[model samples]
Target: MKSNNTAKSFDYTGLKRVISLGLSQSKGLFIGVIFIAVFSACFSVYRPYLTGDVIDNYILNKDLVGLKLEIFKLIILLIFEGILAFFTVYLANVVAQRVIKELRVRLYNHLIKFKLGYFDRTPNGVLVTRSVSDVETIAEVFNDGILVLLGDALKIIFIVAMMYYMNWVLATIVIVILPLMMIITRYFQKALKDVYQEERTLVSKLNTFIQERLTGMNIIQVFNRQQAEYSKFSSINNDLKKNYLKTVLYFSLLFPVVDIVSALATGSLIWFGGLRTAAAGDVTVGNLIAFTQFITMLTAPMRAIAERFNSIQRGLVGADRVFDILDANETLPNNGKKKLEKVKGKIDFENVEFSYVPNNKVLKGISFSSQPGETIAIVGATGAGKSTIINLLSRFYDIDSGSIKIDGIDIYDMDLVNLRHHVAVVLQDVFLFNTTIFDNIILGDKSITLEQVQEAAKVIGIHDFISSLPNGYYSEVSERGSTLSVGQRQLISFLRAYIYNPEILVLDEATSSIDSNSEELIQLATTKLTEGRTSIVIAHRLATIQNADQIIVMDNGMIVEKGTHESLLAKNGYYANLYEVQFSKMNS
Candidate 1:
């Protein structure tokens, strides 16, 4: 969650992690890129040196045969260098692409295992940015940042060696400018890195804002706040523009200064090298010409050094964000070794206590039990801990002090996957993927065939509805099934749960928001669903649970009344008052 973009020192540890991820699956490609780069550097520097060789040894002697042979050798050298350059870029890109793919996979795999609470606190856009754009930035580190910098450095070293070998005095003149160039380059690198970090942070915030605003655009329109939202977006857009301009300004300034310094070095090389040639016949014209070429070659890498550092810092910033999620370790513990092949669906909550936050209990010493093949109805007003019971039963959140058991075995001792497999929950708001109705129902479970889906839909009394669609079972559902009516979507949810054939069924306000006709259909489906399974129904509507074997009335996280519908009404207590009030409202 924290970004280290503006840190004064380089993050060598993060760089190591990025390198490790790149090399994890593509070590051969990475090694090949490095090897190609080394050979390419040698060819690049040697070409300039060879030109000097041609000028001094062959061309100066007026030997046509020697000049032609040297020209042929120069041509061959250029060809080999071109080939090496091509492979260097190609292999580095391959390594980068492979690393990015591996990084995305690792990030996604880590995110899927994180507990619900982690998601509750994190923005959807932040995670999306990290997984996508931020991970993509890391590719530059391999292709254009680290490897390119390495090759350029190697080339500079070879050019310096050649200069020193040909004429030490001229080499010293060129070398004196380097220390100053490095000092300036280092300063710009640090400055650019800090600004880039701030820029990246702003980008994340901007993405988060855009994602949230788009998701809630309907609310903005309904509330007549379009202009207000637009203004907010404009402000963020302006800030991003300013940040980008700052980057451009720094780059514009840095490159010109580098060019100016390179020009100074070239001037000094010509002035000093010319003097020695004119005075004592010490320095050759070929050596002076070659030194100029070496200076030009050295300037390229020198200028690129700061730019490459910027790229590396950008990648490091991205790597930090990605590794933040990868190292979160917020996943649920699946230490339980017990896997039940078949669960009998006996559920019990004994003296349960739970709180999403400390000292703010959502469930207070709650005790409940449902025998196999019995439907237990839980009734409560908003925030009375009704849905919390279902969540606890599903082990979505661990209890602070209690034991939740299925078939008299503690749920903690049961494999999380197996426990969820045997338990099915149908929420009031059903979520369907933007996919075919059949695919949504099967959910990639290869065992659930089209035939099985149709049969399940038929059993749930929704087959006729699906058959009426243009594409029948293959009809596409929009995002969150917005294209489907609430009733129709509910039916799809019912069919999905039914096909699973879970041992325990949880219907959490399943029919509370639908029309009477849809409710009636769902009522029939519910009856079929809870037939022989231990079922838990959380409802705000009293009439829906009148036939429930036992009705538990909850108030402020405690059960105040519990009995059959008749028994609770006869007692004329909390349940009776709730039932009377709901019926009066309906009749009114």
Candidate 2:
């Protein structure tokens, strides 16, 4: 069953926020929709009056011509009301589409600006749910929920007015049952609201759980943990199912109660009308018929209000969740006025210090420089902050206390877009979009031509493989490049990084996942690619970096040694000890 458990919480503040922000985006359309609603309501109430008038003044008097005229009036009014209804639906939808568009864009803009730390700490599945499903839920509110409720309320007001004007006694009788229905609605609403909020939270958890499991399916299967995973998934799925069933149960109980009230209301109208007709007979037959119709209309709105209220409440919950994302203040502050059109690769890290968590520094007073056209390799034990250095230099995360500069200017003062443009990163685990190979290589940068990409791929030795594909460069890839071999995907990463032609290239274990045959191919391409550009390599294979101009070895978040490979080996220090241990294990 489809779930209605995605409401975060019951907060009118979110609805108010949406109205405040959404109005400015499509105010004119909203105003037009309201006007159409008002016109339709006013025009519809006239028909009941006309129905009674046709009977009392024409049919009762046996004036056939007059009755025909009254009938014509009703037909004309119906046409006018139909046109107004069309306008209401069309205008409201346009306004809803506009609001949804602007709202999604705003949320996405905020997501892109958020600090990397937020992403590191937050689950990918939660973010994806916020961006995709939650945003879509908000759109339903605009399209069908609140706007429909507003129109319904107006129609009910007009209906009540007509009923009272026709006969106050009958109006009073119908109005009595409404209070009872409303009380029941309120009670059910409270129960459902909490359930809705819990359901939404569970959806995110389930998404995160499924996403992680699918991502690590290989590990799970290798470890033979399928039964364990199945049990865990069953528990979560059952929880979601229970929440939905509760919602179903509440609704099931609600509508039947509404139907019972509706039946009682109709029964009372007939009994009262007949009693008066049999006695003093102040109420005419025409009035009796009209009162019955008016009572039915009034009860319809009473029944409908409950459903509309639920829709509105659900919308409010969605709005609350979306607002939470928009209100985040954890975005990286990149407000530099400096803009560099071009940079000559010269990177310096002075007294750099950082921590993913406070009171635990990852890089401790580190200092280093990469001169232009130099290949600098970083070797370190795990947790030595080798990857942390690459992350800081790329401005993916800021340092705690230090100055990182490019071309003699602090990167903190440079435009974030421009600063990142000069840096390229190729990770050991490559990620590929589900798109054509050409599109993947170009990465939406229209300035780079196809010829340029193919040429770069050729130079990097991936062109032949791409050409062998059914669609060549235009071949469609799957999510994360699952369709391609590990070596093939890694090679594509090199091509993608190379095509950008960044001044500073950082390869963080880029060749670690490749087999020996593929490793040899990358070894040949690495030299040609790193030439005439400053490069930073992080690798477990010492052979790849033996010819590097400089080698920095780190231990426990501190750089303990730096020199040429032979020089470091000559020192027989920590680097030499690590190399011997690793190579000896390989030989064994």
Candidate 3:
């Protein structure tokens, strides 16, 4: 998760690669569009020709029969043109929709597979903007810009050629202004593109600010910081407004300049053609009229080029943002060939060193081991690296140095999914999806039967609690489980971990949130659950781990004391001091 500035500067080659990938998925529709566009361009040539005929053989000569024939041909040509235009628009839209669908799915899938560290740094709103806004912009580019650009370029060429064939003098006068028009358009395009890029970037930032404040509105209100938040939002909003105004101003300046240039070109054609006609030249009144129409047609396509180029620049900027996510390195790679069929639950950490930041160690030279079916209690103050150990065991982040092994093979040598499959974690901060209670319980093992879910819930002493609900196991949990009490969420999370029945379990203050009554039941259930599994418990209450097979007391990322409860008590060291403080607090 780089800053927005860094993201903006991300290499566009990757974006082009992704665009190429998207187009490859719809080669058939693209080819069809190309074919229809050419056909449409061919039909466009007939308009100027018919107008010339009506002038030379009918208007000047007063041949009513010739006029009727020319008018009939014009009607037939219009009918064909209408059909080609409809299909070209239809096929282009179809292709655009398909490309957008595939691109969105690919981006979402890539996002889900990214490592935990990636999410830790990226804001939800930034990711959402890339997935939604960026994809939509690219789709618009495909539907309007690419399709029209192809057809219009062809149309311009054909129109110019027909005008020249009808009468080269009028054609030359009309075409001479094109070079000047092009130069002005190019300048406008570059300026507009720069402004549009700024506009899009500011929009993403505004979205991020709004999303963050809205999601944390509760915190803002509780802290009585509404005015502060409003001020912050206003700052970002003002930035967005400035960029938007600049973009609009550039577009405003562009259209008028183009219109004036086009009007001049048309007036020049009419004036010069009239002179040639009066000189007894081949030009007729109908030819001059058709020439004006052809020049008008040129205005649309030329202006279209300007509009299309602007849209393309905006889309490219968005694509760059999207490709940044797609190209992110997965810090945790799944390169392991071996799968643990049945782990012995034996774990070892030998001379392990780790740090999220370089050269600043969080855990240093740590060595420890747990036997099969053994309970290891880790007790430490806050920021003592208790969570870091669990993170390493789960391989959420790789170690900077040394090794962590399960059984005999290094954990890194085991398939990441399989390694995690053998381990289950119940954390203090539980997360439940907006789904039924039964579904949440079975989330750890989707294949578990209803009976299995019930059995695990009963063992964890939450079956009756869930049964008491209005919908029982079918009850829907609101977002973040706002409908349930904190203790209830904890109970449900414990049941989820028990249903998995992994060989290794880690509980990080899992019971700290529950009331005393619920804690007793959870303790009882945890005792039963760890009977034949390796368990690591991190708790603030020393009484909870009195029966643990062994206790390792940590301080500053190092094990200061290790022994059974009775042995550590007799040693009168860090463990004795910790137990005495807790026991004194309870008695008071």
Candidate 4:
């Protein structure tokens, strides 16, 4: 079932916490960034002051020497301001990259620790988006967005202070337009945020569609569904395009509107400052020129603030998605009570009941026990809860009620890792990485020698087949072992389990996919693999398990009959009927 809380908005509290965490890691660079921003703002104020000084002290008095000195001072201040700006950008970029790297690591580690159920429910594309695109967005916010906000805020404060000191009446005229600009910007920011968020969601969906299609391309071709797939992809692509256009349109309108407002503010300053100078003679020509420049400067910071706010909104959206994954509950605790230095391989299941969902039980009050080194065979129709029993015994999922003990201790009380270490399963569907055959076989114990790998393969009757290949045991398998046949993959899986030397061995229809010749070899290998271990074989072929010490017949999540094959045949019950059906099919 899907989570109920999926539709919630981005967590603002979590976002603030993440920002705080990032700042704490690179506090020094953060402090330096602020210092440089303030330094640049102060330097910006000096230019207008120097220009006013040039007009009052030199131009008005016809002092050429003083004009030359003021110009030189302006040049020096510009150079210093340039240096400060460069360092501020450089330091912020450096810190942003470092913090992003650490954040990525932390996110990846958290994902790895999450329970298998999380991966089962989450789409791979969605997780990939959080790790890649989301991190990139946050990095941009740190590097460019934060710096813009800091620099512009300081610049705006300094400019307003200077404007008021020079002439309150002219400053008031310019400031009057600001409140309207702010109101308009507030509306624009809200509308833009929604548009951008929609765009981001569409992008994520498109990514997921592409990833799923590419991974299953073979199935599409086999089913002649290429046209259908193309149509689906095109539909999503068009939606993405629409979202992108909407986002761009909103931004386009916002930028031009802000620019027009700033222009109007500038015209107001020029007109009002001219009238004041005409009346009082207190404002010189150079001071009026400086006031115009200050009004122009106001535009830069306003635009910067608008852009920064836009970035922050998008960043919050991305952060919300990332944190959603990080906050998922982990797997149930494996707090098995018994700790065994060595397992004797006896396993018992008593009155075990389990259900992935309530009122839909898959395994019902099952009861059974196997002696150490005994081979127990389970036979049943499809959906008979055969696999569910193995899953429960392996502790993949806890039982709803009842007890399962391995070597006489409750499975839940044993250390999870240690318990899993001693149990091995060879399943019908095998998964192999893109690595050498030897490496695949030795996956359970990488420290084992190559000779040990060969020995295990030989026991599983796959050594000759592996050696016949061009690279022999060193031959590299393709991803998912696509280059190998199903039978060959199963052989490799058996070898892997054999190499682990597990105390308990499980074969869940392991030989069902192999040909008769390979099945014979696998049966022989299975005998060797389970020679000294407790073995549970879930199979459809009755002949294969005829020699088992115990045979269980399960139907609809219950063990209907249990006994030796000979005894069950004598009883003429569920096992006898199942055996006859299979035997008649084989004879025919």
Candidate 5:
């Protein structure tokens, strides 16, 4: 879980995987788009030659009736072309949107299965960018880019063929310029692709910075460091600006090179074709005119090819990043098929060795157990692995060694979904969604009714407090329940766990930050929440867990002492020392 802010190299394997996945799922739509594009290319190639025919057959001959007829036909073709262009844009987006929907869902499913430690190192903003901004960039590859590119490429091919059929010598003049244009374009592609990746990385960094600063705005304002924070943001903003400018710089240079090459091709067509027409009386004036237009058509697609090629490269960069997440080896395994209809909640951990990072063990061979309907409290200093126990039992992270069991059955052999469902937790830092209080309590468990929520709230003695709100259980809580007090959030969490009706309940320092009044209410609620359930409480106050059937004191990842609170106080060891310190603070 160690954080590494290193740059990624180009991953073509990932690029291919992304392309295959997107194309395979959108095969019919892609074929339809290509067919439309080819039709557009045919019209493009035929139009210039049609214009040449009009010049030679009507205007030069002065046959006004025939000219009128040809002009009317051309108008009809132009209208049809417009309609084709419209569908080309529309259908490309339809395909892109469908592919993006599937990819985004796949990314979410893969990301959620990642081990908790993976998130410890991965920033929230970076992931947000992955699922949102980067995915959009990938969509642009098809929507704004690839469909147009296909039309342009076919147009170029058809134009070249028409020119050669009219006059090969004139076609040769156009062909000679292409190699140089492609070379310049290749350089632009490499240059733009590199900068695009750097640009995306900078964007992710900026997002991370913004997300962190906004979340910690209270801290920044209290310390009056707004100016300092502004300066840091400016620095990041400048880096993004510079990265963007590098892409712009490459584009700025590329367009001028393309323009110069285009002028040279057009000039050669007019000069050489004029001379040959004058000397040999073979090449027609109409051929010269058509050749210039043909060169224009061809060079436009070349420019497009370069531009769209750059866009595709940018999409590939995004695809590489997304694939990296999907390809990670850190997902939690769900190979076990055993399901529990009703858990008896007898839990055991034997010689459990665990670590967030390699060789930096956080839980060292800890052994403990709780029988059904029994209550156990884990007492420990910060980083002594108290919370780590809950994490392992719920399979949030797999233990490095040894076993955890519930009701004499190994938890690793139990269905992960069922195991998590029955082992409910009210975290110290409760997170409430910005929604109605009733929704937060029910949390999408359709089996639980609103009445059940009220019943549980009453059991926890918060029914009156809830009903006092303007909308009762329907009252909206602000983001992360900032509108509610810490204790109130804790109470809602208790109600959430209770409504779920899990067989094992974990209260990890649930009352640590609450006011005395809230603590008393929670103490009354705890009895009802823990009744008939195996309960594990981790608390610093010590008073909340004094009646715990067993208390285990840990230090530096090892269980240093274990017994009931009174029995441990009699032993006068680590638990006794911690209890005495808290008791003295309360007395003072």
Candidate 6:
């Protein structure tokens, strides 16, 4: 996503930053590429002059021996030019690959440290495009942008100088066409710059749309929205097509105009040089031929300059996008110096208030406490701020006001990593990676061994069920554990949380989606998982938390009642009514 301050024209700052980073990677390679490009440009300009000398000074004088020697020298220059050209392209790409690799890695590392709100607000596809596609575009700055432009610029300079030295009148004729060609190029360059910006924007939209549609294909199919979704995709795709056509239209207009001017210049050179080539005239057969070659060489780079300018513009546009991510201040502030080596599990929320959006508070002046070894269950209807409490506890979002303390220190004052390390949350929607069951449980933590994982699963009473699978703990799971039943995935999540051995455990409606048989196993697992840990449980099913040391009933972001199950039942208040509603359903 582009910010309001995004540059609409050529971004010089971004270009400079990209160049600085590239040089930092390998200054030797960059400097070597430039040196080779200069030499290559000089060779191209001199080759035509050598060809003219062979015609006038050697071949025309009937000196076959001198002609062969000049021809041999020409061949050597061509061989060296070919060798330099190969190295120039090869080294430029090597530099590009290395630079983008560093940029991509840095961007990814920055993304991982960003607060959850950043991902919540920005689409995953946009970030993916920035990290992968946009970074690739920056490579054009090296392969075809900067160094190529330098070589072309140098070719123009050398060609013009040589033309004037040979014949000032002919050089002036070619120079007259140049300003007009440049004016035309400038017009197309501006038009194409705007089009390229639009093109990248449309591509991001296309990528974001496809990513979301594929992820939600099930919902689209279930609701019979295939035709409607297709229509939406077509609209986005059509916009991209139109954007590409605009780019084509500009180039289509640009080239013909440039060719016309180049042909006129070529025609003028021959007309003047032919008249001058008469018997007492100063221009010889060789000078006329060399001047003709000069016209061709001069216009070639001019034409290429127009194209390369756009390529450079496109890369600059991409660099702006990539740098946007790098410059963003979206990462969590980890300024606390206190390390949490251990915690007593005592939790407190002192008049805490928070909102995902300003003036739309989700948790309002809420306060609560749990002892070192106790279970605190919270029950509420949807949107009653049940899960918001858990999010605040984990410091996923900073509080609007007031404070939350763990053991006696304010959570804000604790090291962010250490604070999160001691808290384990098993969400209702369990997300598992596409790996073996053992890997998912350990989550790449080598400190937790397979034997330790097996032992933890046994304690949670899911060991036998896992052992029944063909690969046992080594069984492969599909993305998000889609191959497993909801109950099975949830069971694994509990085992994952348990293995971490957190000081505070949270199960946010963990058992709501389980079947009747799996519910018993989950209930038993919950007991074992929360045995000595200070636990917070959020449940829609009132019966699940009957044994909680304290049950807090909430409404509209505020707690309405708090007490033990038996005590709340005696009050016949919010908790009693909630319990009664579910109790009646169980009987019916």
Cα lDDT for residue 367, candidate 6: 91
Where is model 5 more than 4 Å wrong at Cα?
1-16
Clashes per model (N, Cα, C within 3 A): 0, 1, 0, 6, 0, 0
**Candidate 4 lDDT, tens digit per residue, 1-588?**
122223433335645755675687888887889888998999988788779778878988999988898889999999998898888888878777886787788789888766565677678887788889977777666677676578888998898899898877767777776687678767767776676567667777887888998878899999999999999999999998888788788778878888888888888766767776799777678777787788778777887777777776677666666666666666558656566778998889999999876799998899999999999999999999998888888787779999999988888888888888889999988999899988888874658999988877777677898898899988999988999888888888888888888999999998778876577777778888889899999999898899999999999999999999999999999999999999999999
User: What is the Å distance of residue 280 in model 4 from its true position?
Assistant: 3.4
Which parts of model 2 have CA positions greater than 4 angstroms off?
1-10
User: Of the candidates shown, which would achieve the greatest TM-score relative to the real structure?
Assistant: 1
lDDT of each: 0.87, 0.82, 0.82, 0.82, 0.86, 0.88
Clashes of 6: 0
lDDT of 6 by residue, 162-257 (tens): 888877987898789889988888888777778878888888888899999888989999999999999999999999999999888888888888
TM-scores, all models, native as reference: 0.97, 0.94, 0.94, 0.90, 0.96, 0.97
For model 2, residues 1-588, the per-residue Cα lDDT tens digits are: 122334433456677777666588888777777777788888877778788788888999999988888888989999998898788777767777787788789989999988889998899888777777777667656666666667777877888888788888878887788679778878877887787677777888899999999999999999999999999999999999999898889889988888888888888888887788789686777777787677667666666777766666666666667778787787887877798877778889899999999999999999988889889999988899999998998888989998999889998998888888899998888999999988888889999998998888788776777899999999999989999888788888888888988899999998777876577668766765787899999988887788999999998899999999999999999989988998898899
- What's the C-alpha lDDT at position 95 in model 2? 76
TM-score of 4: 0.90
Candidate scoring better on TM-score of 3 and 5: 5
lDDT tens digits by residue: candidate 5, 53-84: 88888998999999999898889889888988
Cα deviation of 270, candidate 3, in Å: 1.0
Each candidate's root-mean-square deviation in Å? 1.5, 2.9, 2.6, 3.0, 2.3, 1.6
Model 5 / residue 144 / CA error / Å = 2.3
